[model samples]
Target: MRFSVLSFLTSAAAVSAAVIPSSSSAPEKRGGSISVTPHDSYSSSIGVLGCKINTNRAAYWPSSPDCNNICVKVSANGRSVNLLKVDQSGGAHDISYDAWNYLSTGKNATEAPTAGGGLAATYEDVPMSECAHLLKDGKHLAFAAANSMNFITSCSANTWVGKNYALYNILNTQCTWGYDELCRMPDPSQGNQPICEHTLGLTVALKTCPVYNIAYPTGKLSIAV
Candidate 1:
């Protein structure tokens, strides 16, 4: 049997591209001991999501070149939040340019995203407005990032409702009921649950965003906040 040499080369290149880390700033550990505040006692109203990378194992590169699927620990401020391990089998699984752009560059509501390139911003520093852009994009990338960073699924719903959770605004809205089901904390009520933007702690898990800070030196499987 003859194997196609060109096909092997092409496959190798594709895999190389997927796994390689783009040139960018590596996360530096701040001078502080590792700390984790539990979700039950944690309290905050800022609505920020940060990704603490435990182990970047994903073939796809995140906005931060160093980021990978390796166990991302979601946190708000300095407290730890519980994340549901989701099976992204159904529906779409893609990260949009706009979402990727914001994640890589910390693009805010005011700034428009360019075509390509990565950013140095960690999940913690990424502004809420930039996150809003991702949430509003209504793509699987938004959902992926949300899940990675442990953003409240209901938060995405409220985002879909936009500024007040009043009218169902498609532009402001991101994911649908289907997306929410992907989360570990699905709406207990039958059918789709009502949009509750202002209400906090609607779901069993505490509200949180991504925390991209990783504990690099220890080589431990944890994203420190």
Candidate 2:
């Protein structure tokens, strides 16, 4: 086993080069209380999804260099938006570059994302003309009453917040029918529920919420808008 100096040098160089970016281009302190310009709400017509985020919205750094998972809030023109994150390959950011860019630099986000354009753009503030999920955020924000539920062995129809909401079975993503069954619980049960992306995405608790605030019924957690 004669040692090849060239091979050894090559391996060392490659490994050393890989460590450079990690030690050099560390991501900046992400997530803070920052204000954004007052742009129109994200609409299907304009090509954005989710709630019409204003200054009152809260965001999480899901992936931030700060060990605290600590997010500092900021505003622009008195509005706040969260910065989605990017850590590994094949992530939500790849599909939602517009959102990513907006989080990166709030100045441009104030402007409209490309209308019917593809996601991702050069920071020139121009339309990509390729993005198509503009209507996605709206669906995500639409708070419709839970007509279905998961993981619930049973459920019942009740008037919550003066509206009708369904309590259903727990449906974790173990099986298709199980998930479906969980979404449509017409009875009541005690257990974990299979909550889907759409369910979590839409916290329609306000439209049909619980009647009493057991947390601090006597003091705080009062049932009020």
Candidate 3:
């Protein structure tokens, strides 16, 4: 389930709004409140199809991919710790257990904080080049797949046509035919069925067959003399 950094750069067609800056000067700092939560499976080490991240070094999950692999400087309780943005929190500045403990008490505790609460924090996105020592490879941040199952299945098929066909099937079944842009309408002339269009500049042949039945012997047969 390992993905190279190159794969991510190519597949991620749309760039997020929080683009990492190219210059060496400090980036604009964003301030927000942080909530401490218990570490999950992806707490310490990198998870399946996830970026190479060292969560032990004050890692925090941001709300979007824009912050992926970006080094963040978290300041709170008159203390500041530089942490990496490794995973998604669905909300801004979701600090990991160990990280929060370190930030508040100045001790990286194995257990959760007794007095759990939110902390006022300011996050500054440090450029990847500047934070090379913190990164795994010093340059690359392996982008995690949004949908690992779909990624694996499509990669296994290994064809643009196959991927498109799979996408069509998913859209046809899950999405509204007429309302959704990708979903196709059921053609009344073709038995009111939805079919893959050949307009994709490639010809695809689809086939169907009836189910086969198997019979078992009821009794031994005697041969005629």
- Cα lDDT tens digits, model 2, 72-151, are 33333333333311111111112122333344445333243322222222221111111112212222221111222210
In model 1, how large is the Cα lDDT of residue 46? 12
Q: What lDDT tens digits, residue by residue, belong to model 3 across residues 77-183? A: 77876665544444545554455666777765443333355666666665455445655455443322221222223222322212222122211110111111122
Ranking by TM-score: 3, 2, 1
TM-score versus the correct structure, for each prediction: 0.18, 0.20, 0.42
Residue 184 error, candidate 1, Å: 19
**Predicted structure 2, TM vs. truth:** 0.20
Q: Rate the local accuracy (lDDT) of all candidates.
A: 0.23, 0.22, 0.36
- Which one is best on lDDT? 3
RMSD in angstroms between candidate 1 and the native structure over all alpha carbons? 18.7
Give the Å error, residue 101, model 1. Answer: 18
Candidate no. 3 TM-score: 0.42
Candidate 1, run of 10 with poorest lDDT: 37-46
lDDT of 1 by residue, 98-127 (tens): 233334344421254334322222222222
Better of 1 and 3 by TM-score: 3
Q: Higher-TM-score candidate among 2 and 3?
A: 3
